[model samples]
Structure formats: C-alpha cells, structure tokens
Target: MTDNPTTERKGHCLCGAVKITAKQAPSHVGTCHCNMCRRWGSGPFMELDCGTDVAIEGEENVTIYPSSDWAERAFCKICGTHLLYRLKGSGEHMVCAGIFGDIDGLEFTSQVFIDEKPAYYSFAEDTKNMTGAELFAMVQAQQESD
Candidate 1:
C-alpha cells in the first residue's frame, strides 16, 4: 500500500452511463462519519482523494447537489450511483470508493467527524480520527497556509 497518490484510476457508475477518471487517485482511503455522509449513504462514506485532475464523462447523465457551503456531491442520474464528493473552491474530488472495483494499494488510513459516528457500528481498522471541529480547523489552517 502506498501513502501517496501515484497512478491513474478509472471507474464507472452502476448503469455505465457515467465514467470517472482520476489522474492521481491516492491509495489511501478516508472515511467520513459526518451526519451528512451517513444520511447520504446510510453509513460512513469511504472515499478516495482523487485530486483536482479528474474528468467526468456523460455529464448530461449526472446530477450535482450542493451538500454544504464548501462541498457538493454528484451522482449518476441514470442509476443513482454516487459519483463524487467534491470541494467547491478547489474542485477536488473525493470519489466514491464503491465505484472502483479493486485498486492495487488502497487502504483505510483516516477518518473525520468521528464525534458524529454512532455507537452501533465501528471499523476494525486503526485510523487517524478527527472530530468535526478539528477537521474544519485543520482545513481552515491548510487554506490559510496555501
């Protein structure tokens, strides 16, 4: 498993109406336990940080929803397959891991909104966890540094 974004990865929606291409799909997976994520997927959202270099074919077959002030979610309109969770300003996509069949070095490494995670379920993997406030602060700090 690699810690860095190395190779290109491609995947499509359930109905094959839409395709996602990531120029640098990271091997690391980040889990989101925020309320919005859980409500969207019925559980934590496991995603790959596919940086800004992403292409979405069949744009006409997809739907985009502004989930928050800083981010938006997209899905295949044909099959309702979740496609992306992207940052507004950077246009950085954290694509749905489920869409990708099997990636070589994918591994669970981090998690956010841990405080909102319910007690009914837990992941066996050890991950770097951060609360909602911590996550927001971290992002803010990163943006400031940039």
Candidate 2:
C-alpha cells in the first residue's frame, strides 16, 4: 500500500490559483453519469471519496452554486475550475481529482447513474451501475452510519 501521510496530494484550479489538499486518499473513486455532473463537468464526472481530509484554503477565489435541491457545486471564479460537487444533505463531496498531481496507485472503481448517461458516449470498462435513487440511498445510509 502507498504510504499514508506521504500519500497526501495537491490539486489546483485551471489557472493554478486555487489549490486544495487532502491527506487521505479516496476510499472510492468513479465517474458519475448524472446529467448535472455531465453538464457541469462537460463530460463524465470523476468523483473521489475523501472523507473530510479534503480542504480548500483558497475559498476567496472560488464561486459556489446550488446545483440541486440537495447539493452545491464549487468552481474557481476566475479560471472556472470545477472544484467540487458536495451533497448538502448527504455530506459527501465529489472532487475533481484531475487537478491533483497523479496519485500513485490510484484507481477508478465504479460509475454511478449509468442509466442516465448520454447516448452519445459509452464506457468500455466494467463498472458497477446504480440508479439515482439507489445512489442516494447509499449515501443516506453512509450518513446515518457516520
């Protein structure tokens, strides 16, 4: 396994102004197939599950928008960096791990909401598929456990 504290990573916005740090690597990583994720991310949305080790120090330069009734999306105001998509009620965050330097041994495990994915594109890789309701339920269960 990769060293714990040494595995900490850094990520920055498109223009390199906004930066983020996470000491813990993701427990789960995947591409999201929801319409909002696609529209906001402009493609398959990559989400990293870092349980609160994620921290953004440059909040002044970022803009936040409520993308859904239960979530918020954050981006760099100046460079339009897709920073994070956090579920308000669930307390789960889907961060753009691309900004972070290549994480050694990192892997993409699953894809959620595959049924909602656009017809124009398809993923050849094997992944677990879950509907929106199922995904929401999973998140809710996690929150309750926490």
Candidate 3:
C-alpha cells in the first residue's frame, strides 16, 4: 500500500444506479477471452484489479451471477452495465475498466484465455498472453501447493 492518491478511485454505472469505490485499485488492466466472457458481452472482458477493498454505494441496484464454478460476475441491474468478475476463493474483484473512465498510467499488461480470442478482433499492445489451458494449470498448481 503505497501512498498513491490514485490508488483510491471512484466510478459508477452507466445509469448512475450504482456507484463504486476501490480503495486499492491497481494500474494494470487485463482481458479475458474465454467463451463465457464472449457470451457475456459479445467480446473479451476488460477488467481492472480492484481486489476486495471495494465499496458499493448502491448495493441494492447490483445483481450477481455465479458465472462459473469458481468465479462469479455482477452488473448494474438498472442499466445492464457489466460491472465485475469476482474470484470465489480469494474474493478478488476485477471491475470493468471502462467504468472508471480513465486513469493516469494504466497499462494493458496481460490477456488470459488468449486461445479463445476471436480472429476478427485483436489488440496491438503486445501484452503478455496466456492460453486457457495454461491459466487453469497455473491455478491448479497453486491450489495444490496451498
């Protein structure tokens, strides 16, 4: 926890029905290109690492869905904005980067489930890419060690 003023950021849903405050937001952004993500919004899911230090001003306006066996997703109930993807075990929240408008030095660091990414669309940022199988393997390795 560095004394960076930008670490604490605030954002809201498209219709202003729900507001978000991330107390320790990271500057790195990533994308998930799994099939579920594509079906969720017809494209890759862009996310920011918001961890668990998040505050929801209008919690009643958000709806969460257990998208996978180990992860869940949420969105604004009023405007249908895809809000976040959360990890079940660690309780980590990766919020949608679009909702935060713009941060000063955010970086497109990595792309997961790259093998599932569609051929028609691509990013030219030269990010670190990980295939879906590699992602699961890494998770399994970690879980076994724990």
Best by lDDT: 1
lDDT of 3: 0.88
Q: Compute each candidate's TM-score over C-alphas.
A: 0.96, 0.84, 0.91
Task: Show the colliding residue pairs in model 1.
Answer: none
Candidate 3: where is the Cα deviation over 4 Å?
A: 1-6
lDDT of 2 by residue, 18-97 (tens): 88886675645678888888888779888676556678878899898999798898999999889888878656666787
Best to worst by TM-score, what's the order? 1, 3, 2
lDDT of 3 by residue, 1-146 (tens): 12223388788999999999988888888899999999998899998889899998899999999988999999999999999999998998999998886577787888999998889998989888999999899989998999
Candidate number with greatest TM-score = 1
lDDT (Cα, tens digit) per residue for candidate 1, span 1-146? 34575678899999999998898888898999999999999999999989899999999999999999989999998999999999999989999988986677788999999999999999998889999999999999998999
Mark the 10 consecutive residues where model 3 has the least summed lDDT: 1-10
Residue pairs in candidate 2 whose N, alpha carbon or C atoms collide under 3 angstroms: none
lDDT of 2 at 28: 51
Candidate 2 residues lying further than 4 Å off, grouped into runs, are 1-6, 143-146
